[model samples]
Target: MSNKAAVLVAGSWGTALASVLADKDMEVALWTRNVVQQEEINTKHRNERFLPGVDLSPRLAATTDLEAAVRGAKAVVMVTPSSAAREVARALKPFWHEDMLVVHATKGFEIESMKRISTVIAEELGCDEGRIVVLSGPSHAEEVVNRCPTTVVVASQIAAQAELAQDLFMNPYFRVYTNRDMVGVELAGALKNIIALGAGMSDGLGYGDNAKAALLTRGLAEITRVGVEMGANPLTFAGLAGIGDLVVTATSRHSRNWRAGFMLGEGKPLETVLSQMGMVVEGIRTTKAAHAISEKYQVQMPIAAQLYHVLFEGLDPRTAVEALMGRDRKTEMEVMSLETWEQWHT
Candidate 1:
């Protein structure tokens, strides 16, 4: 196979991953729909709109044609927003070949079907769901482009495929680990955005670190509870895709979700916050999906529920916090059974 990899959509994350592949001495194709952005990346080696001031790798090439990007590529990484994942996958279906490894870095659920990105891609490609790998962790595109030391996990039901992905992206600056808990990894990656939104809202409401810590703690609990119900390994929630992603996305200044939630907590309306952020805040859309999932699965997701209300129902952020704090008390380990706790400890 040729040492060529394609990254769909030359957004911040996509561009950064493409750079990683380029650093690995692979020919990288960075695809963008915007003609101007493609020209800028090709000529100047910069994506000023999404990642300003960062010079992309010289080995990374930009393209506007999807087929040209994917053709003869060993791997195709889908980094489009969750909202556009299906459309982009459909566009790729005609060019995709069985020999190519498919991976997605998207971290949100489909609001309409509540399907994960891998599932959407599989449906679009008419491929087995298990063949798709999910790459996730506490990764921020800005830090990654700067060659920051970042560790992430790639998971798939097919262990070989996961290992293939691990080998593709592994390098000195960026570490890649393999896991088989695709469901857990994907769920953790997607669901943590909800808590990040809540954490940002808490901080914007002038709550101290103590309050934010409590939110993070309880938020992990809610995430683990629902994730376990959804057939994910509970231990995955404690791993990189779960707590690792939760901490970074909730607190990092580079986090669009946190920034958007902060604006909302500062009393900005949803529409205004979204308009000003100039990026898709996955948490807002994920909150809607999580709310529906919680209800459908009969899981209690007070944090996500509160976030859904704040984002969609126009509930006051402070009032939502009040509601969260005032909820009926329960045991800290309510979601964990005795057997599960013993298994974890032993």
Candidate 2:
């Protein structure tokens, strides 16, 4: 297998991961259409627009050529925003090979299709869905590029593929774990952004830690509720991909979702917030898809529904909060997994 790796769409996360692979002394080719970004990365060893002030690795290269990017590479990491996942994968289709280890660090569903990132990639590449790997957890691109101590999970239905991804990306500054709960990992990764938005809005609204904590706690239950119904292992939500990701993205200054939510809480319009964010707030789109998903699965996602109204229905954030609180009093612990509760007793 070649020691070269390819990462599509050199956004902040893609650049950070490219540096990680290059730090492992593996040649990395980062693909992007932005001519200036490509040249900056190649000449100055900097991707200033996305990973400002962080010096990229010398072994990493950047290019606009999709074919050249994946050539002779053993692994390809798709890190484009969710909106572009299909288009980028489609472009790579003719170049994709069975031996290439396809991994996606992109989080969020294809809203129209409501499909997971791995599924979208597999469908576009005409490959076995089970073979693709999902890389997720709380690692932010800014912290990761600075080589902050970071950990993440790579999940696949095939244990061997998960292990292979773990080996390719892990290093002293970064740690990787493997799980077979691909569905749980992917769902957890995408859904947490909505909760993060809520958390950030709580802070922006001048609510204290108590409000934030309640939001995080209930938000997680809401995520797990939807996840288990979609065939994920409930335990996966308790691990790095679940509660771990939720906490970081909700609280961190680096989260685009949190920032967008904060702006919304400050009374900015959704369009204005998105324009100011200058990045894809995955949670916004994920919220839309999840609204449909909750309907499709006949699941009650109260928090998600409220978020949908605030984000799209133009309901005031405060009103949405009131709606959530004013709902008929209910039990705190609803059965999370739709599966047999008797399993717990067994």
Candidate 3:
């Protein structure tokens, strides 16, 4: 009921969301550890390193003191990259309380532990995981900051928690939908980045739309397979967080995963590609986690497996593509039959 909210970190997406809240007339305090970045945001209303040429809302303020940012806020939005999520949540513990709404927009698995971002945050906060809401969909920071029409979905095991996120962030240009399948929503958002990287790789290798289309189609199947095995509803894969997110992430030039994949396809070494990115390309890390998850679940994830070899085992991208083309054939329904759906959901 307080119009005050806090956003953790000032990355591209984090800054964009802060702007959204500020535009809606909320007092938004964004926390960042970098003193220079904090001054730039507060003084110039510009975050050139992240959102170039975009004017941040004047109502949005940046702070170097984490407690000052979080102490009185009614809501806290966690937008740190997946790698830093646990550490950030740990730091917020002293200032965080159950009365504050916890929502996260981060989109990746914890590569080392294969844990979802919300899980990591909940563990650190010592609260029920259901109290955390996940915000996800086919959104890019560049588009959202420009006030482009965008729709996103929020999920929580608890309906009221999901509604809390929906009410806080929804606006005319930014539409929010609610769903109860938190597991499906979180997994879909994270896994789709891996396919986007492959899509970029296909384009970088001079492949046509036909190849990309097939890749996207099969990639969704792979994502749904793993997600269902991990307690996600199969039908959730047909919704926004699933197909909608997959289509946008794999096709958009704004996708960090796609850009990194293109570089890898252009024959740059993984180390060089990462150095050139300057920002975290989440798909690279998600690929590693997906590899481990697929093995742990005993699910076949051909696209993710080939990508892992290329990324970590020094396999040529072309050879990886060739191996995929030569894999044993099976009916498309082998993994997606109506029976499969019934079995997964039941």
Candidate 4:
């Protein structure tokens, strides 16, 4: 296979992935919305705003014209922030062809539609499911650009598409796994960001490792519950997209979601924290959508509920924590148990 591909990216993650593709001898076109970013990549061979200090390969170039960026590309790897995924997808529609393979690296649910990035792509592009792929895992953009060993999963119902993406992007520092569980994979990736927000809040609250661990574990349980109810595979949550992503996102300083939660935990207003981060924190919005989804599905999502209150209700973070602590005790596995499942349906 020729090492030539195009990547649509607007942030550090995009730059990092572009750098990876270029390193693998792929002729990568890195698209950006900002003209200054395009100049930086073309002139300095560095992405000053995103992946600073890392030298990008000469094989990679940058552009802002959406049509020019995607023209004639066999594959399109979208790394725009989740909040902008739909808008970007809409903008790309007129340029998209049936043969183009689209891959998304964003990990968040659209708050307005409660749709995953892949779904947003499909709806916007009017494309078949086989043409879209999602790449996710325990990866930090900062680390990935630095050549840290990372593993990710690529999910698509069409094995050929997934395998094509895997072959195109995989390298020694980056390992790729494939799965057919698109819904489960997408849901696992999007929902984990919400849980990571809670985990970061726990740390900001000065909670111990046990608290963080408990939150992470139970957060996975609830995420799985919601996913299973929504027709996703239960086992996917136990795999990379689920547990793996949750752990990395909840703990990493490089995670914008975790950082946003940490700020909230420290008593900063959501608006203020957001202004300081100056980037889209998918978890904040995902918390809202996840809570709504849970309510719609009649699933218990205490973490998402607490997070929503902290973010939107103007409730004190400490008070939110107390409320969660005061909930009536029940078996942790009750939600996932078959007997309880039968009881719910009955």
Candidate 5:
């Protein structure tokens, strides 16, 4: 297993990263729990379920064993979805070697504890602050797999860790930037999806770009407020993981959160939407968690609050919009951070 790095997981994003690394001629092994996916990557060179129609490099080997994935590896990337990050990290703790530069490619906070993915990796994997790096931004799996131009952020307490990840993941099309605000990067990544869900709901209701634009702008305001209160640097939210991710996820058709919101706006039941979309809708669960975090910090998040009621309390989306519209008049800046928009009219 002597290699530049071994990826401890393989999903669309993971496979895309593997492809990028393999392009660099970096020896990388990808690990997956799905035997079928491993066979597909090894035999056919494509992952049909997660990354269809993309041919992966033969240099990128796939495996199912965790120990084999990490043995003699200089670095490791964990790209599983957020819900599975904790269990996977916990399982990998015994095999992880000291000095392994562990890069976390997953986003979203833990639902139960509202902890960010990097925190979960540090806690569950027994890694110190220097060992964990989070890579994020407006990267969609579809675009990345296609080798479309993309940019992302690498955040870690240690500059060396960030620089290591930046050196590995940066490419002509896929650029990587470094940041020290892990809290802001992780929070921005998770909270933007919540707002993207609401944006999709607005589209499902046939609301025009005006409404969707309003949601995106206002949603970012609340995200920044919560980030500031939670000890995240406010400027980080103004950058890639914050406003950058919000724009893409909220607008892109590839976004699962937006699709879920679209279904909700079209009057589909939550269970129906969930069943149709086999993948986990991270934002639907994150809405509840965001609402709780907002209350804990005394930060006002009206969009998240309404979304929480809509998704959980069975409130109608239209009525939710009306409630938001009919709330008592306040200065526009009080409710949102939009400086260029017209004041809400009665």
Candidate 6:
């Protein structure tokens, strides 16, 4: 087994994780489709486009060739956007060895299939879904690259595999925890981006902290509701993958989803918002997938539904908030019945 690990993209987050491995004195290969980006990382040690002004580790390398990146690597981290995860995994299939640990940091679903990223990777790689680990939490790429104190969770159905990932990326500044709840972690990570968009929209609308707090609280409840319905542990929503991720993404200036929602809340069209942002706003696509998932699972996600309307159906942001406020009265625990509580406890 080699100490080499490959990150399957040179995006901000992927580059940051690659830096983490490099800081551990492990050989890290950052794979990118852009030849220019590859040259920039290899020569300048700076990815000016995605992560500017941070010096990457000297041990870090970049490549445009997928085979060179994956061959004989001990671990492969897939950090492609959720929409590209399937294509990237398919490209890795010929190079992927069974012994190599597979992990993904994507936090959105396939808009067309409503499939989680792990499902997409497993199907594409022809591997057991349990073998794939998910890395997620409150850490932002900008802060992470600067060696700021950050914590994240690596989850897999196979405990040993998750521990292997934990060992690979853990450092003094970057703490890694292991969990068995891959489904919960993945869902919480994906769903939180939706709430972040709402939070941004609230802020843009000039709504005070009270509204943002309400959105975070009610958002967690709805996310937990749908995740539990889909076989995730409800408690997982309270952990880093849940509230931790939600708070950071919703409030942080580094969040692309929040910025996109802010622009939309300022009355910019979706096309204009996307054009100005120049990044993949996962929440927009995830909102579409969540709308479909909510219908498929018969789960109620009022915030997501309203977000779907605002992002896709051209509903005004203020009108959407108004609609949320105007909804019929219900108890705070509307989604959790006594039977549900007993089932979770049992």
How would you encode candidate 3's per-residue C-alpha lDDT over 37-96 as one tens digit per residue?
999999999999999999998899999999999978999999999999999999999988
Q: After superposition, how far is residue 30 of candidate 1 from its true place, in Å?
A: 0.7
Give lDDT for model 1: 0.92
Question: Candidates' TM-scores?
Answer: 0.97, 0.98, 0.98, 0.95, 0.94, 0.98
Candidate 4 displacement at residue 85 in angstroms:
1.8
Model 3's TM-score against the true structure: 0.98
Off by over 4 Å in 5: 335-346
lDDT of 6 by residue, 223-307 (tens): 9999988888898999999999999999988999889878887889999999998889999999999999999988899999999
Residue 63, candidate 2: Cα error in Å is 0.2
What lDDT tens digits, residue by residue, belong to model 2 across residues 267-321? Answer: 9999999888888899999999999999999888988899999999999999999
| Candidate 2, run of 10 with poorest lDDT | 337-346
Clashing pairs in 5: none
Worst 10 residues of 3 by lDDT: 331-340
> CA lDDT, every prediction?
0.92, 0.92, 0.93, 0.85, 0.87, 0.93
Give a tens-digit lDDT track for model 5, residues 212-299.
9999988888898788777777789899999999999999898999999999999999999999998778898789889889878777
Tens digits of per-residue lDDT, candidate 4, 1-346, equal: 3345678875888888887888788788888878998998999888866666888788889999888888878788998777888889999899888777889988888878887789889989998766799998888989998899999999998999899889878999989999988888989988999888888888898997998998898889898888878877788899999999999999989999989889988888988999999878888878888988988878889988988888989988889889888999888776464744664466
Per-model RMSD to reference: 1.7, 1.2, 1.3, 2.4, 4.6, 0.9
What lDDT is reached at residue 127 by model 6? Answer: 90
lDDT of 1 by residue, 35-102 (tens): 99988998999999999999988899999999999999999999999999999999999998888999
Q: Which window of 10 residues has the lowest lDDT sum in candidate 5?
A: 337-346
